[model samples]
Target: MSEVAVRMRLLQQSFDAFDESAAARLGLNRTDLRCLDLILAKDPMAAGELTTAAKLSPAATTTAIDRLERAGFVTRSRDAANRRRVLVAATEAARAAEREVYGPLGEAGTSALRRYGEEQLAVIIDFLETARRVQEEQTARLKKLPVRE
Candidate 1:
């Protein structure tokens, strides 16, 4: 592979390790943290949409929501407009964890970006956007594959 490819692989590995460490420090298992992230990103999302975004089964999603609610990280309620639908929202606890856990990383990244010229930052942005799109495609592909026996 090329130097850029190697650097990208290293970045991904580092990010995975960072995420795992942050999740542990924040007292969340991976799935719960992931669910919380999605809910925080799209507050008051339909219950089914949160489940789909988390790639969790209906039963699993219910349990996760229950767990989050009990932990005060999330709240679930009937949609006012549609009584038949359930909605999930992130609570202040979730926002607090986000700020406490991810704030430094965001700040450091922003600081680093500030050191770059506009042209260099443009290149970085382009690379990051493309990499994210490819990673998403890979995630979709891997989800379709059966687990190893």
Candidate 2:
């Protein structure tokens, strides 16, 4: 595999391990925890936006939101301007849960970045921004493609 692919795989493995360990501690499944985290990160997102961000089908997103609401981790409200629109937001409990779960991981990442000098850190940030742009372009391209056998 290419170096980028290898690095991405390693990063994904590390993230999955971290998430699984945290999920066990929180007594929640990885998916449930992820949904809560996303809600915490971006409050009052429409149900459709949640489905797109979570890469889940509409039905799965609805079920996930239902579970989160029942667990008191999130709440759903109708948009004041658009009553037909449903928005989901994280509860205070969910914010606390995120801090408890990901605070250490964030600290570790920050420490690693600090290990690099300012110039190196700047380069790393530029590379990450470029990667983000490239990923967005690729996603748009893929969305435009027709299904194939």
Candidate 3:
């Protein structure tokens, strides 16, 4: 692999480690954390939407939501437009926790990026977006494959 590819792999590994640590610190499993992240990104998100975004089965998504609700990270409510539909939203506690855990990292990242010019930042942004798209595409492809147990 090229140096860039190796660096990208290392970056992914580091992110995975960070996610694991963050979830543990918040008293949550990785799946629950991932669900919480989706909820935070789209506050008051539909439960079904969360299930799709998290790539979880309905039952698994329910369990994750239950765990998050119990941990004060998320809450479930009936959607106003459709009483039968459920929505999940991050709680104030979850927001506070996120700020406590990720605020420093965000600040550091901003500081690091300050040295880069606009064009350099644009290139970086493009690379990250492309990487994210590739990851999403790969995840969908894997989900299509048969289970290998």
Candidate 4:
């Protein structure tokens, strides 16, 4: 494998491990916690948009939303513009839960970033931007391809 592939795999593993540990602490599976995290970041999204953003299949997204709604962590309503569309929004309970779970992790990450000098931070940001652009381009290319199966 190439160096970039090796690095990407390592980063993905590290992220998965951290997310699993955090989810366990909060009594949630990784998917459940991730759904909550996205809703917390940008609420009032249509169900289809949530499915796309969460990278989940339509059925899986609906299931996740159902679970969250049952747990009182989110609410769903018909979009005023389109009654056929359902919009999902986080409840206060969900926001508070997210803060409780992620606040410490955010603080620690911020502290680590703070250890870098301005030039080092700029380099890090530039690398991240490059990675983001690469991923976006790959996604666009893949999306244009017809399904082989």
Which candidate wins on TM-score?
3
Which residue pairs clash within candidate 4?
A: none
Query: Which of candidates 1 and 3 is the stronger one according to TM-score?
Result: 3
lDDT of 1 by residue, 1-149 (tens): 59989998898899889989977987777888888889988997888998788989989999989888988898889999999899999898889999999899999989988989999989988988998999999988998999999
Which structure is stronger by TM-score: 3 or 4? 3
Model 4 residue runs over 4 Å out of place are 1-9, 135-149
Model 2 pairs in collision: none
In candidate 4, residue 71 scores what lDDT?
A: 77
Q: Which candidate's lDDT is highest? A: 3
What is the C-alpha lDDT profile of model 4 across 67-102, one tens digit per residue? 888878899999999999999999998888777878
Per-residue lDDT of candidate 2, residues 34-121 (tens digit): 8877877789789988899888999999999998888888899999999998999988888887888788888988987888998998
Cα lDDT of all candidates, in order?
0.89, 0.86, 0.93, 0.87
The lDDT-based order of candidates, best leading, equals 3, 1, 4, 2
Clash number by candidate, in order: 0, 0, 0, 0
How far in Å is the alpha carbon of 25 misplaced in model 3?
A: 0.7
Task: Supply the TM-score for candidate 1.
Answer: 0.90
Q: Which regions of candidate 1 deviate over 4 angstroms? A: 143-148
For candidate 3, write residues 1-149 as lDDT tens digits: 49989999999999999999999999999999899888988998999999899989999999999999999999899988999999998999999989988998899999999999999999999999998999989988999999998
